[model samples]
Target: MVSVDYLTKPLDIFKEMCRILKPGGLAIMSFSNRCFWTKAISIWTSTGDADHVLIVGSYFHYAGGFEPPEAVDISPNPGLTDPMYIVYSRKLATA
Candidate 1:
C-alpha cells in the first residue's frame, strides 16, 4: 500500500484482506507522506503523518475479525524526505 488514494473505500479493502488471510496471518499496510493529491481522499491528503496511522488503524478496527492494529514508523530519515509508516493487524484464529 504505497498510496491509499487508490482505494475508494478503504474499509472494504480491509474487510477483503481479513477475509482472505489465514488464521493469525498479518495484514500489513504501508504508506508514505506523499501521494497524488488529486487522487487521494480528503482525509488522506489533509491529515498529518501521525493521523494517517490512526486512520489506517480505524480501518482495521471497523473491519472487525482482527486483532488490534499496530503502527510503526519506518522512515530512514525523519525530516530528510517523505516519511514511511506501516499499520499491521492479524486475523483472529477463529475468524
Candidate 2:
C-alpha cells in the first residue's frame, strides 16, 4: 500500500520494492518518460518543468522481481512519442 510520486528517486523506489518483496516475490514498475510530449507538456504546465526524474535503463539490476524482465511498451507511436517501458522483475531466492 505504498504510493510514491514522480519526485521519488528510482533507486529509492527499487530499494522500497526490495524491502517489501519476499525472498522470491515479484515487483512491477511503470514509469513515464520526460522525452514524451505529453509528459513534456505536463512539465511545462507544472512549475518545475520536470517530466521524469528517472530513466528507463535503471531497471536492469536494481529492479529484481521477474527472472526475465517484462517490458510493456506505452508509446503510441514509436517515432512520435517517447517510449515508456514498464518492467516486471522477480526477486531471487536466497539460502
Model 2 C-alpha lDDT per residue in residues 8-81, reported as the tens digit of each score: 36566676677777877877665544533443333333532122322332443555442555556666787687
Question: Which candidate leads the pack in TM-score?
Answer: 1
TM-score of each: 0.94, 0.47
**Clash count of each predicted structure:** 0, 6
| RMSD versus native structure for model 2 | 7.0
Question: lDDT score, residue 41, model 1?
Answer: 92
Model 2 earns a TM-score of 0.47
Q: What lDDT does candidate 2 reach at residue 93?
A: 73
